[model samples]
Target chain A: MSSGKHYAKGSPKPVLPDDGQLRLFSMRFCPYAHRAHLVLKAKKVPHHTVYINLSEKPEWLVDVSPLLKVPALQLSAEKGQPSLIESLIIAEYLDEKYPQNPLLPKDPLKKAQEKILLERFSGVSSAFYKIFLQSSGLDDFSLALDIFEQELAKRGTPFFGGDKPGYVDYMIWPWLERLPLVEFALKDYKFDAKRFAKIAKLIELLKADDVVKSFYVTPEQHIEFWKSRRAGNANYDLLA
Target chain B: MSSGKHYAKGSPKPVLPDDGQLRLFSMRFCPYAHRAHLVLKAKKVPHHTVYINLSEKPEWLVDVSPLLKVPALQLSAEKGQPSLIESLIIAEYLDEKYPQNPLLPKDPLKKAQEKILLERFSGVSSAFYKIFLQSSGLDDFSLALDIFEQELAKRGTPFFGGDKPGYVDYMIWPWLERLPLVEFALKDYKFDAKRFAKIAKLIELLKADDVVKSFYVTPEQHIEFWKSRRAGNANYDLLA
Candidate 1:
């Protein structure tokens, strides 16, 4: 599954031509785009990534995405208009259209549970993102992390869905992966990464898996990107 | 459908026992709770409403609803357990168990559309709710209404779905009915209610229909209640 599109370290970037293939317009540093990438990787769905510079969005990118946000996917085939933006909607659409490894459980109750967890994650992430934006004091950061740790503690198993990584895990992991960057931003924040044992274990498990590891990037890169973003030295056009 | 339960004008209140037949702990004014109310009425599902005062939530209410919010529903028939929380989940549960006057459309795409609209309405309502809470002047209110008007304009028909009102309509209409209260609060600020023509027209259409009007209250009363709420004079608990 990984052989066809392997990127050698420092290799020339892959050209994602508009040849009616599935083209994912994304910024590598974005958690949202990373979410889409994870889903495609887990499902083994082939797609071309067009890295959009967030500071200076390309005319074609804006033309394709009304929201002009990264993680915007264009599914162009031999016929019909290319399907456009919104990450969650696109992920669900892909899950429905291509039924390889099911992301959502079949039972309605189980599916509802997954959705609830996703909603909680969204709420938690929003709070954390706000704190990150303001470079708010450590007290707020610790409080937000404590809430997340408490939520992670409620799950029966290591993963949100108990055993196999499901929709909630995919939706949530990207943000969790970016937490180190957040921690770097607020150096005074006192939350120990190990305090969230379930999350730590889940991250370890996911990183160890071959399919998951393919999409994983080091924490150092994440911290560097965010630091540059906060300094206003880096253009964030890809995320716009 | 309206026979069993009567809120007759100028009559002594009926001796409604907390025998708990079915306890719906809700704030009557909440759009989310209104969704449950519309379904219960449509199905004629008999339940006694327990208005949970949000500001000073009783101990039992907190025990029943950890979130300490209204729209919590409990079935007295089932000995003792936690009541169901979250409006959309409760609506689905009712539709599944009762199966009368199904709220959801049968077709998959149509169901998807309802869910999308419901989500959109929620997003819009959340934005407006924030503006209503934090706005010191009319500018914020006008901006929020402008966004709401644009979203309403995107709808192809009077109802979010075509002719008949469905789940999305019930989910959204209650909130729109309450918008005037926000407007009243910003009255001195010179906010223009006339600018929201489409929303006003839709509310009028909803209020005139037999099915919708069955549970509808006068706009003036709705506005008055919500205004009192903003002033912290009225108890929301009485509303459930």
Candidate 2:
């Protein structure tokens, strides 16, 4: 479950070895890819990662990823390393394949609830893209954030899944982890921390992973990454 | 397990029974809702359905579906008939609850493959919306359809999950069912049957369900419903 070592973006993808190891294809700052990293970390699944340059994608990625997106899990099977794309499906795949520390609840209904939460959180990502790309629609996102806060109040659970941070938490946290960067870019824009107490607390717990040694990027770096992408020339080597 | 009865569109919703019974909230012509109807049929789940007037959404639906969309499943339990919304989530809930005749493949990797297939098919829906709404861009949709056909060919499976139709087949079948309707709206547009032979076969299997007595509406009816909606006065009672 150790944080996957960073493979320099634009580096050639390593050969699909017969060693039978689960490999993840991702970019350092992509939240969708981060979802896979969080699930792998939470489940303590031993795996490796190959960072892809979105601007200059490797041809090999398409062989595995039908859509050529990251967070594609290349399973180490005797038959061959078949790749699985889409973070939600990959997360579910990890949960099902490695049953030792389950990310989803044991109860079917509760598990369904976790998935619904993931669906509900889609608005936040949409808001993020709209704000970052078009530089509009911040207020619309706040409505979704408010609903999320209300849901937390209604549940009265420390995390979405009672005491533990289940799939929903990990699924949502990847984006929330980068919200600070959004705030930095969009001045005078911030979450009402007091109103979103649970979220604020969750962010705090998520902050420990921001240390330089940690697997994921820090909020400060994310802001720079956004600035680079906005210029139409993404600086993938900012942290290199 | 039995097929759910369809409610007349535009009719008032039936009283929610206190007795436990799975009820589906849907619109007869809605392809998204049709996804759930197909799953319920495949699983043979004995559920009731309330056809909603999407144009005139009921207040009660908002209580269950935050987005006020249909394909919401209300599960009768001792506590209450808790409702689940969104076609995919509700479909998963149904699959999880009714273990018999599983919609998804049993193997984790196979299950992941099915989900990725569903995700890949999403472009078809988006392309459908773009072409239908903007009244242009048929070629792009054909490319997506081409990928889908190629996928079925590559796998050499009767269905996306192999053999009998499963979740992927049901989830995607709804949109493909409407492609012909789109073709009706836009001339010189048709799925290449020879290219998509597997899909042509699936359509043959799907047509029997298109009989007047089936719970869902036929593709011909879908074209009429779409025409009605386009004119800004939907004829929900077209089938009636």
Candidate 3:
């Protein structure tokens, strides 16, 4: 029973390992896992990344993560007692356990707002993905992108939480990375990149950051992978 | 900001209403609002419930809630101040502000587990609702329901948090109430009510409780509202 305030003010510094022992079981393609990667990079937290093959999931990985989801964290040498699934929760846990560079704001209201943004992003992204997968037409997809643009515009900053990237930014930025591919897919529908100028600018800013740039992949590779999947290439490794 | 623990040990008295006057702007039929209702009922907290017409949302309601979603909770009398939106966050806020009955377990691992259940339930319910709306074939619907049944069986208890209902229960139970209608919609799917005996027992137990029973509406009314929506009768209030 960890009995203390939710936000421990003036607590002793958290002891982190000198050796790189934090193993992150993640797939590069999963938006959820990408959230954890972005946060780790932003915080400068040293961790070994273990890319899992979703199809023939390793027995050891399956034993640790019952759900077999990507972005499972294993701290130290503990195998069975690994801190398991959920990207947001894992990011939050890391932020709490190692609190030097805070991902969440101190104000309760601000924290609540961060949560709302995360929820809204999750909802909007799900809808966007559904429309993208089900309908080849870009009408609904454009509307979704427009909504994202509007949301970013309202923030009036490069990131969701104004100034420095926080929890919301970590969760949202990975999904935004796939936008180039989405635009490529719907090129015939007059999908203008300028329509999401604010978002594109923000993405550029994120990619420019030394820490944020650590997770960047070429947009072409992402599109090629999806195209392969669409062509019945079941053997393709989604984790790449 | 009112700051003090909401509940004390032993007596189990409800926290007095906030000095700013807490008012809940919600629709009766919304599962999200029912989350707030459950927390209030469990804690014996009092608040005014304003039922808003979904078809013609009032300007005041829209002003308070930009998303215009039901289950928004106003902590203070001031109209323009940001109110808590989203069911899980509202429930957590209530639990944090007024610590009666301890809706969440204090341990971090257990708390994580609770969140996983909430996330799983959210995913399953959203998928089920979509399938239900599309009136997909029984085989497809059954596959979805099978997943739900499997998840529930894993719980090994009626309530989400082993024997006792907690945050996850408040988060999920409202959606579960529509199961009868869901069953009716997929009547030809060999829907086995017996497979969900645990859920059935839990529902009966919840209904037996005065607090839970207060939120119940007849299945006929629920079905009528759902059917009306399908028939393009947009004027009918689904939340009522």
Candidate 4:
């Protein structure tokens, strides 16, 4: 089975080769999985991506992750070995385990600030869901966007990681990539690029990044996926 | 204004002393705040606690925390400085900054595993809330408890951190401390100590720790606070 195809319940589990390589159980369109994907690419970690059908999960997933969630990283091919779950934890593990491209700052305070920044962005995320998915809370979404704009402005840097797309940038990119779909879906809504210049520039820079490009889904494709999801028949294997 | 007292909306903001010391903004009864409190105590981090009335937050809270949440760690006494929020993030910051008693493992894989374990425990916490707070999800809570018991038994450790309480232990302690309140509130419920012998022992070990003792709220007090909260008038200053 090809890695890009999401393995569903009926599909036979792919045998793990004896060769030592990290395996990431993921769902193609899951933003959480995207977080791990970006980190793996950013850090250039040696890993294999295995897309799983979250709607109809594979039976063998229980062995891979105790949580039975996507974005679980199996450290090795060996059976009975525990796979790490939760996207941020996997990203942090990869960052610490492979120290080539350091995503987090060395200073503990600075590192915490970035983590806090990501935490604060939860506001933006919830508001985004309300506006785009539920078709409500437009004002709240706008407010969240304004706060994000101000945060970007306050940092006074090209990127939140200070001149480089680091932890916060990669973590946030998945959501930013989906913003265009909002405008596409709703006729009344559009993000004011002029107003949120810092974020606007960031979107462009991240879109151009080599790492993001590899896993990047086009806005149209994202819209198509969401449309399918809304219609109650999600196409998890859109790429396939 | 002593650090022990809960400062409310009308209260004037306390001046930051020229002395450079860490300050923690907290709500005495909040479990999340308790996590940071435990970490601070366990690590013996030099800090002063400033209890906040979450119902009616202090006007100056915006200056301390952008999110206006408890467990925000002000790294220094200097004004206009950013305070870190989110309990785990604050705990991690303290562990990194004050490394006398390291809460997290030095090995990246081991550290990630601990974090993953904590993430899994969210099920137990949520189930606890559903059962005790909302009077539902008893079966779910039982299942979560069974999973926890199995996890503890598998590790074969006196504490989640093995011999001593570490990150997962301290992080989960707040909720475990509150479990007795569940049995108290729900007459039909009682944890099977024999069935969950491992967790029962682990809880005993944690409760006896010096650090846990310092911030320990008696089960009676927790019940009182919850009763007050349920009655729509929470007593934030139970100690005061």
Pairwise DockQ winner, candidates 1 and 4: 4
lDDT of each: 0.65, 0.75, 0.66, 0.85
Pick out the ten consecutive residues of candidate 4 chain B with the lowest summed lDDT. B73-82
Model 4 CA deviation exceeding 4 Å by range: A1-3, A77-80, B1-3, B77-80
Residue-level lDDT of model 1, residues B54-80, one tens digit each, is: 555555555666767668777666656
Candidate 1 chain A: worst-modelled 10 consecutive residues by lDDT:
A1-10
B-chain TM-score, candidate 2:
0.88
Q: Best-fitting candidate, measured by DockQ?
A: 4
For residues A136-180, could you state the per-residue lDDT of candidate 2 as single tens digits? 878877877787788878888876756767677778887787888
Instruction: Give the CA lDDT, 0 to 100, for residue B77 in model 4.
Output: 52
lDDT of 4 at B118: 77
Residue A198 Cα positional deviation in candidate 1, in Å, after optimal superposition: 2.1
Model 3 C-alpha lDDT per residue in residues A180-218, reported as the tens digit of each score: 666666555543669878877878777776656777766
Model 2 segments more than 4 A misplaced: A1-11, A15-17, A208-213, B1-13, B209-213
Give lDDT tens digits, candidate 2, residues B1-240.
312334433445567655577877777778888888888887887777777777777666666566777878877772555677778888887887789889887788887887877777777888898888887767778777888788878888777667766687778877877777778767767767887787887767656543212655566788888889999987766765
Off by over 4 Å in 1: A1-22, A75-86, A137-155, A188-194, A235-240, B1-23, B39-48, B74-127, B130-156, B188-198, B237-240
Error of 4 at A107 (Å): 0.9
Kept native contacts, fraction for each prediction: 0.04, 0.79, 0.21, 1.00
Candidate 1 lDDT (Cα, whole model)? 0.65
Q: Residues B1-240, candidate 4, lDDT per residue (tens digit)? A: 255789999999887675677888999899999999998888777777888999999999988887798888887754566699989898888889888889899898888888877777778888888876778887777777787788788888888788898898899889889988779767888888998898899889988999999999999999999989889899988878
For residue B19, model 4's alpha carbon misses the true position, in angstroms, by 1.8
Per-prediction TM-score to the true structure, in the order listed: 0.77, 0.91, 0.74, 0.94
